[model samples]
Target: MRHTLTLFVTLTVFWLLNSGHNTVLMTLLGLVSIIFVLYVAHKMDVVDHESQPVHLSLKFPGYFLWLLKELVLANISVVKSIWLGNSTISPCLMTIKSSQKTDLGIVIYANSITITPGTVSVDLIGDRITVHSLFKENIEFLKAGEMDRRVTELES
Candidate 1:
């Protein structure tokens, strides 16, 4: 029931912000669309915790800020490597272990790896993830487990 309410409010806000139409007709249309979406989602049984993820809301901002910082640092590292030529690149394919207890947490860890400029998550199975990185240091960074720890904390 709470999830449904949250979804409804989220959809309404999203529609209002994106549509940017204040007229009655537009408002009615948006409401209709939101209702249709809610009905379909209820039927599909996807409007649960995984879909809404309200549990992660409190920790998400901190994780996002960390991710943003990592993104900038990775961009700089990649650019520096490019300027220094291929000789400075040490590409590696390695498998790393993840400690996250949920599918969402594992996915967040894998996606975080893929999002950072120098690394790509190639595969994820159970608690293990295989990654390909432009720089060996990127793989080492994953091995260090700070991002994995943070994502685990987010899920907790």
Candidate 2:
């Protein structure tokens, strides 16, 4: 029930912010659309913990800020490697251990690795993620476990 309400409120707010119209007709239409979406989502059975993720709501903002910073740093590193040419780049594939206990946390960690400019998560089997990286340092960074730790924290 809580997840359903959260989804509805989030959808309504998202609609209002994107639409940028407050007229009665527009509001009514938005409500109708949101209700339809909520109904469909409920019927699809995706409104539960993994999909809605209300449990992670409070911690996600901080994690997002950290991820944004990491993305910028990664972009810089990739650009620097490009400028330095092929000789400076070291391509490697490696497997990293993830400490996340939940599916959502594991997915988040793998997706995070993929999104960071220099790395791609190629596979996930159980607690291990196979990642490919343009630079050996990127793999070293993953081996250091900061991102994995943060994602594990998200699960808690």
Candidate 2 residues 100-128, lDDT tens each? Answer: 98899999999999999999999999999
* List of clashing residue pairs for candidate 2: none
lDDT, candidates in the order shown: 0.94, 0.94
For residue 17, model 2's alpha carbon misses the true position, in angstroms, by 1.5
RMSD of each: 1.0, 1.3
- lDDT at residue 94 of model 2 (Cα atoms): 93
True-structure RMSD for candidate 2 = 1.3
- How many angstroms is residue 40 displaced in model 1 relative to the true structure, after the best TM-score fit? 1.1
Rate residue 88 of model 1 by lDDT: 96
Q: Taking the tens digit of each residue's C-alpha lDDT, what string does model 1 give over 4-26?
A: 99999999999989998899999
Q: What is the TM-score of each candidate against the true structure?
A: 0.96, 0.93
